[model samples]
Target: MMEQPLPNPILFHPLKHHLGYLRDFAAQSITWPEPELRKAFQRIGGSQLDLYIGPLPSLQIAEEVILYLQQRHLLTPEPYRQHLVPVGYRLCTLSDGSAWALRWGLHTGRHVHLHPGRYSLHTLRIKANHLKTALAVTIASIKYNQPISLQLLNQVRAEWLELPPVTGYTSAEGLGKVLDLVPGNA
Candidate 1:
C-alpha cells in the first residue's frame, strides 16, 4: 500500500471572518455615542475578541461583544441592559448539565451579578480583569486548536464558587439557579 500524507487542518479566523457581521449587528442594535463606537472598533484587535462563527448566530458571541464594549465604555448602559442582560437571563435559565453550558452560565452570572454602574468602578475593573484573563486562555486555546485545559475549568469553577450570595433580583435568581446546578454544590 502506498503511504499517504496527513491532511492539513483547516484554519479559521473566528473574529476576522465574523467581524463584518458583528460590526453591522452592533451598529444596528447598540446605540453608541457619536464617533466613540468607531474609535472603539479601531482599538479592538482581531485576537481581542473571541467569537464562534457557526451556522447560527451565537448569543454567546453577542454577549461577549457587548460586554467588551461595556468594559471599554464605548456604549451606554441601555445597550447592556437591553442586550446583555436578556442574553444572560436566557443562558442561565436554559443552561444544561454540560460543562460548556455550565461555564457559560457562570460567565453570564458574573456579568449579571456585577453589572456596570451598579458596582464601583474599582470593583468592576477588578472583575473585568479576571474575566479578561479567562478569556485570554480561551482565545489561546482556540488559536492553537487545542481543547480547553482542566486548569481553566477549575479556575472558572473557583470564580463561580467565589460569587457572593444572590440578591433578590430576577436575574440574580436565575444566576442562583445555575449555582445550585453546579456539580458538587449542595
Candidate 2:
C-alpha cells in the first residue's frame, strides 16, 4: 500500500472565515474607520481597541487563511512559510488579569509580553520594507481602518517568495518586474 500525505498542522477553526473574508475583501479593499472598527470589536466580544491590531492574523481566524493560501499555491517559499508557523496562537496569550499579554516574535520566536500599541515602529517599518506592497498597504489600511483582500495578499506573497522549485528571481522586486509581463492582475 502507498503512504498517504499527512494533513497540514495549521488547518484549524477560525481560518476559514478569515480566509473567506480576506478573499472577498482582496477583490476590493474595505476600509473600517476607527469608530466603526471599534464597534466591530464589541460585536465580536473583544472589549478593547488594542486587541485588534498586529502583523499576524487574529488568533481565532488565521489558520484557514494560511492553509487556503497554501492550497491555492498562493503562499511564499518555504523560508517565509516557516517564519509564519510560529506566529499563530502558539505565540499569543490572553492575560488572566490586566489588559495585556504576549505576542510572538517573527524572527526570534520570543514571547514579548506587553501592552498593545507599545511596540517598536522602527521594526514595523523594517518588516513592511521586507514584505513589500502588502505590508505597507495593510498598515495603511489598519491606520485608516481598511479591509484587505486576497488578490493583494497574493500579489505581496509573489513578491516576497517564489513559487516552489525556485527559479529565476530572488525577491519582491523581481516578482514585480515579472508581474508586468501579464496584461492584468490575473
Candidate 3:
C-alpha cells in the first residue's frame, strides 16, 4: 500500500480568548478564594492569569521557573521577587484555557544550607464543587515553596507556546498533530 500524507495541523499564536479561558478555568477550578489567590495569577493580555510560577530568587531564576512552567500552560509571567517562595509551583491553563496546578516538590521540604530545596510533581484534577478551595490550596503551595531559575522559567513559556490549544477531542489525532511540527524559538 502507498503511504498517505498527514493533514496540516493548525498553526497559530496563543490567542487571548483561549488564554482567558484558561485563567478562568484555573480560578474556577480552585474555587475557594484566598488572600494569595489574587497574586497567584500570572497576567497575560489583560486580567487573564494563564500560568503562574514564582518569585524566584532573582530575575534569572524566575525566568527559568517560568520556562519550566510553560511546558504545560498557555500563558506565564516573567520572574519577580514578589512571587518567590522557598520553592516554585505553576498554576497552568491549557491553550484553550482549561486550568490546573502543576505542583512541584513535596508540599514540605528540608532546608539546604538555610535555603529550601526538593520538589515534587503532582496534578490535581479540577472540580466545579471544590474550585475555590483548590485554588486556595494552590496559592498556599506556591507561596510556601522555594524559588526556581530563569532558564527553566523560559522553558515553561517556550513549551506552552509550542503546543496547540486543549479541545474536546481526545487521542493523538486531535491536538496531537502538532507533535510532528518543529518548534520555533519564542
What lDDT does the true structure give each of the candidates?
A: 0.30, 0.31, 0.26
Candidate 1, residue 21: CA error in Å? 12
In candidate 2, how many Å is residue 48 off? 27
> Hey, what RMSD does candidate 1 come out at?
19.1
Predicted structure with the largest lDDT when compared to the true one: 2
In angstroms, the error of model 3 at 112 is 52
lDDT of 1 by residue, 128-152 (tens): 2223233333433344445545454
Give the worst 10-residue stretch by lDDT in candidate 3.
177-186
Clashing pairs in 2: 15-64, 25-149, 26-149, 26-150, 30-147, 31-146, 32-145, 159-172
Which candidate model has the greater TM-score, 1 or 2? 1
- Using lDDT, rank the candidates from best to worst: 2, 1, 3
Regions more than 4 Å wrong, model 2: 1-23, 34-132, 135-186
Per-residue error for 25 in candidate 1, Å, reads 14
**lDDT-superior candidate, 1 or 3:** 1
| Clashes per candidate, residues 3 or more apart or on different chains | 0, 8, 44
lDDT of 3: 0.26
Q: For each candidate, what TM-score against the reference? A: 0.20, 0.18, 0.16
Model 1 residue 162 distance off true place after TM-score fit, in angstroms: 23
Higher-TM-score candidate of 2 and 3: 2
